[model samples]
Target: MAQTHTVTIPHFVTEASVELTHLTAAYAMYGTPHIQPDGRSNILLVEHALTGDHQVDQWWGPEIVGPEGVFRTDQYCVLSINTLGGCMGTTGPGSIAPDGQAYGSRFPALTIRDLVHFEAAVLDELGIREVAAVIGGSMGGAKALEWTLLYPQRVRAALVLAVSARASAWQIGIQKAQMTAITRDPHYLNGDYYHTEHTPQQGLAAARKIAHLTYRGELEMDERFGTDAQTGENPLGPTLADSGRFAVESYLDHQASKLVERFDAGSYMILTEALNRHDIGRGRGGLNKALASSTVPTFICGVDTDILYPYHQQEHLARNLGNLIGMAKITSPCGHDAFLTETRQLVQIMHRFITRIST
Candidate 1:
């Protein structure tokens, strides 16, 4: 019989002997060591979706990281660190500040670059100077882009999926509307409402509803729930008390409630607002100029059905990446969520790319 033991992993702050100025920052790991007999490791860093946790393979499903999966844990070490401003184990508004209370709305404004910095700190602590590849989709993809830009030497290649170089004006507009809903909520309590009276569950739910629509395509929505009526009573309206709600509305409600259970309102505001501030060009010059600085080879992928980041964005990034070696756009009806849905296609492409590059 095999013996079982419990072990505590070392924190990055302790390992590096450095102080993390942020109120919170946590990370998780997966797979066996990627070290060769010579002692060098091939590492894959996966960035997660907006509400995603560090359990990448688990959340996205085992198809992406199992023994026979594209990532092939037996061959390479995989790391998926929750973003800095996330409500996960990582530091964020929900974390208690130095003042011994939650940072709340006072959490420092963080950008994708800032999240990359946190990841770099983790890598440095782990003595990993170079990663075999960085992979991400949607918000995760944004972080992947920043990683290549900020640490060109450390990231050998980046796989950007269903994401743009910068958040578009339309993206900003939608995010702003979501923020407005949260702020306008009487239960928000100006963000310090933690342990006070009420939480902004309703407002956050509304935001999730809007975001879920963007995550899927119009065709998908049409196919899933065209004009079917929900059987539940209308809670928002006494007038609709007799009439049935649309199936689409029911689906959105399900997404919203799911988010409400695991997500924090203040953190949502902070992260989404930070996403709005996402731009590699901010201080480095412009988008094209910033990307030109990266010496890393890039693998840019898009979903043919993605409306949020759209396929053109990936094409533009590939054109500007200079050292891009692979470009693919998987066809799926799932839109932005296709990356999570179509693992088989991504697996084949990634396996070839990783093997070719490692050789």
Candidate 2:
């Protein structure tokens, strides 16, 4: 297990000018330190996707970053920080406010840039002047892109997978529906149900179910389940209420229940909202202009079957970015979550990029 470290940011202000005193950022480091004399580590900063923490190997599996994995510990120092709005050990909605209450609904709005800024502060505290590479997928990918733009001199290279330069209306609409599923639950109590006996577990589960559909590919789902009834249960009965669920439904329910046990509802909402607001071009002219301005070498990859963030988005990023090395494609049956599911392909692409950057 990776040990957690924290840095205090006194009087931190958000992009919206929301003031937070004594802000804390929790991070975890892996790999052996290869620090230079100038206070910088040969570090590769790995940002996590939504609902992910700093436990990269634990969450993403050892094959992605283990000793013999693509991100070999002996090769480079790896660090991952929980996003500002995350729940795991990080100061988020679950954290206590100055008034001795959980921030919950009162947690300030967070933009993707705010997350980048918070991590940058933590990096400064760690005496890391620059990172060899900053890599991520999904929301993580957005942050990786932002790091290159926000501190072009600091990020030597970036590997962004399964994300776009801006959050699309289609993506926002899906997220809005998910948020609605949570807020509509009475137990949510306007995001202040922390002290209550019951949290919005049902709503959270439903939201997860909806999100899972988007995360996986239709072909994969069909091949896996294909309207088949769950074992020992009949799909058809006298009425729909009396009928047992299909195998796919059971799988989604399991996924939802798993998340509900570990994740806080308020944190989920806050993070999803932050992800919805992920626009790299915002306040920086436009998407093309913002991307074209970056001199940092970039590797943009996308899953071919991804419905949420399709291959075209990566193509656009590759075409617009000034220093794009190449646009790689991960051909997988999984959809948006292929970055996580297809580890072998991801490892290959990442290894290639790391090798190229090192050379």
lDDT of 2 by residue, 89-109 (tens): 878987999899888788888
What would the TM-scores of all predictions be?
A: 0.90, 0.97
- What are the runs in model 2 whose C-alpha is more than 4 Å off? none
Error of 2 at 226 (Å): 0.6
lDDT score at residue 159, model 2, on the 0-100 scale: 95
Clash pairs, model 2 backbone: none
Candidate lDDT scores, in order, read 0.78, 0.89
lDDT of 1 by residue, 9-31 (tens): 23323212434454344556666
Locate the minimum summed-lDDT window of 10 residues in model 2. 32-41
| CA error at residue 36 for candidate 2, angstroms | 1.9
TM-score, candidate 1, is 0.90
- Alpha-carbon shift of residue 32 in model 1 (angstroms): 2.1
